[model samples]
Target: MSLRCLIVDDSARFLEAARTLLERDGVPVVGVASSGAEALSRAAELVPDVVLVDLDLDGESGLDVAAELARCVSSVIILISTHSLEDFQELVAASPARGFVHKSALSARAIRGVLGENGTGSAP
Candidate 1:
């Protein structure tokens, strides 16, 4: 089955662009949220297979959101950011998220790799 995805980013442009790119790349995007509140609301409804949350969400903390999401859902969480991974490597490793994906490196393959899928099937 195609993985259901939810995108959480404060940038309207990134949300739209990411949605388009991910859909075209065969990721089944279920919802988009522009803020932490909207993300939580949508997550309750979508229950997506994966969630791509930007590491920086305006004034709010994405790590905080990640921790809350892990408690609230069964989906795998992957953190994304325009900043370098070296900047937040330790925090990302400590968070409940499965992994970190640079915004520039966001792709279906990268996401699946995190989930241990090789396109044929999920990892054993």
Candidate 2:
């Protein structure tokens, strides 16, 4: 089954670009949110198969959002950022999110590789 994605990023520019890119790459983007509240609401409404949250959500941690999303949905949660993975390796390991995907390398293939077929998360 294909993953129906939701993107959560505080940047409007990044949101548009990411939605466009994911769609072009054949990942159906179900929704986009720019805030923690919005992301929660959209996830409840869309029940997407995957959610990609930016590491910096205008000062709020994306890992926080990922935790909440993981609590309620079976969807795969991926942390995406311009930051290096090593920078957030510990946090990512501790998070309930399935995996991390750099924003520059965001793609359906990358996401799939991280999630695998079951989409079970990686927790520290």
Candidate 3:
């Protein structure tokens, strides 16, 4: 089955662009939230298969949100950021996120790589 996704980010432009890009690449974006509160609420409602969360959600911490999601939901959480992975490697490793994805490298293939897919299936 295609992976259902929920994107949590503070930037409206990034959210839209990501939604468009992922959908174009065959990953169905189930929902989007601009804040941790909204993300939690939407996640509860959507029950997506995966969630791409911004490492920095404006004044909020995406790591905190990811942890909360991990505790409350069954979805795979991935942290996304414009910053370099090296900058947040330790923190990313400590967080509940499955992995980190650079915003510039965000794609179905990249996501599939994180999920350890061998490209034998359709979804990431």
Candidate 4:
């Protein structure tokens, strides 16, 4: 089955581009959110198979958001960032998120790699 996806980012531009790219790459984007509250609400309502959360929100911490989602939602949370993975390596390792994907490299294949590394399988 195709994995349903939810993308959470504060940038409208990134959100649009990401949704388009993921959809084109055969990942069904079920929803998008710009903030922690909106992300929580959407996740609850959508119950997606995976969620890509930005590392830095406008006023919220993406790590915190990921933690909450990991606790409440059954979805595999993968943190995405414009920053280098080495810069946030420790933090990402400590986070409840299944893995990290740089925004520049965001793709269905990359996401599946993360899931596979976490033993979550490649598809839902």
Candidate 5:
């Protein structure tokens, strides 16, 4: 089954880029939110299979959203951020996130790997 995805980023350009990339790779992006508050609301409404979140949001941090998602939904939260791997690792270790992804190198393959998908090449 295709993995239902949600993108939470404050930048419109970044959001569009991510949406295009994921959709091209066959991942269904069900919802997009520009802020942590919006993410929280939409996440509950959509309950996507995976949530791709930006570390720096407009009003709140993605880490906060990750924690909230853990309590509010069953979706796996993957943090996509511009932060360095070391910083991302520290944040991920503290938060209840499934993984950390560098926005600069985000790809369908990498996403699939994080999700533990096999060689099917099909969306999880």
Candidate 6:
């Protein structure tokens, strides 16, 4: 079955890029949000299989959203961010998110791998 996904990012360009990539790979993007609050509200409605969230949201932190999402839904949370691991260690320690993805290195194949798709890898 095709995986359902939700993307939460503040950047319009990044959201568009991620949407294009997921659509091309046959993953259905159920929703998109520009902030943590929006993502939280949408998650309850969308009930996606996976949630790709940006750590730095417009108002609140995405880590906060991920933690709340874990409780609200069964979706696997994967944080996408430009921050270093060291910078986000506290948030990572507090959340139940499944993985962390760097925005600078994000690609369709890598995203596919995160979604448990076969034949996709971290390297492009």
lDDT of 6 by residue, 18-95 (tens): 888878877778899997778889998988888988988887878888888888888888888988768887677668
Tens digit of per-residue lDDT, candidate 1, span 17-123? 89998899899899998788888889989999999999999888899888888998888899999999999999999999999999988888889888887875656
Model 4 / residue 52 / CA error / Å: 0.3
Better of 2 and 5 by TM-score: 2
- The C-alpha lDDT values of all candidates are 0.90, 0.89, 0.93, 0.93, 0.85, 0.81
* lDDT tens digits, residue span 1-124, model 2: 6789999999999999999998997889999999888999999999998899998999788999999888888888899999999999999999988889999999877888887753344541
- Across 1-124, the per-residue lDDT of candidate 5 in tens digits comes to 3588999999999989999998997888999999877888999999899899888898788899889888988888889888887966876878888788899878777777788877475655
Q: What tens digits encode model 4's per-residue C-alpha lDDT throughout 1-124?
A: 3479999999999999999999998899999999999999999999999999999999899999999999889999999999999999999999999899999999888898887843244454
- Which stretches in model 5 have alpha-carbon errors above 4 Å? 119-124
Off by over 4 Å in 4: 117-124
Q: How many backbone clashes does every candidate have?
A: 0, 0, 0, 0, 1, 0
Query: Which stretches in model 6 have alpha-carbon errors above 4 Å?
Result: 115-124
Model 3's lDDT to the true fold? 0.93
List the candidates' TM-scores in order: 0.93, 0.91, 0.95, 0.92, 0.90, 0.81
The stretch of ten residues in a row with the least summed lDDT in candidate 2 is: 115-124
**Top-scoring candidate (lDDT):** 3
* Per-residue lDDT over 34-119 for candidate 3, one digit per residue giving the tens place of the 0 to 100 score: 99999999999999999999999999999999999999899999999999999999999999888999999999888888988765
Q: Give the top-scoring candidate (TM-score).
A: 3
Q: Arrange candidates by lDDT, descending.
A: 3, 4, 1, 2, 5, 6
> What's the residue-level lDDT of 56 in candidate 5?
86
Candidate 5 residue 44 Cα shift, in angstroms, is 1.1
Q: Residue 67 of model 2: what lDDT?
A: 92
State residue 38's C-alpha deviation in candidate 1, in Å.
Answer: 1.1
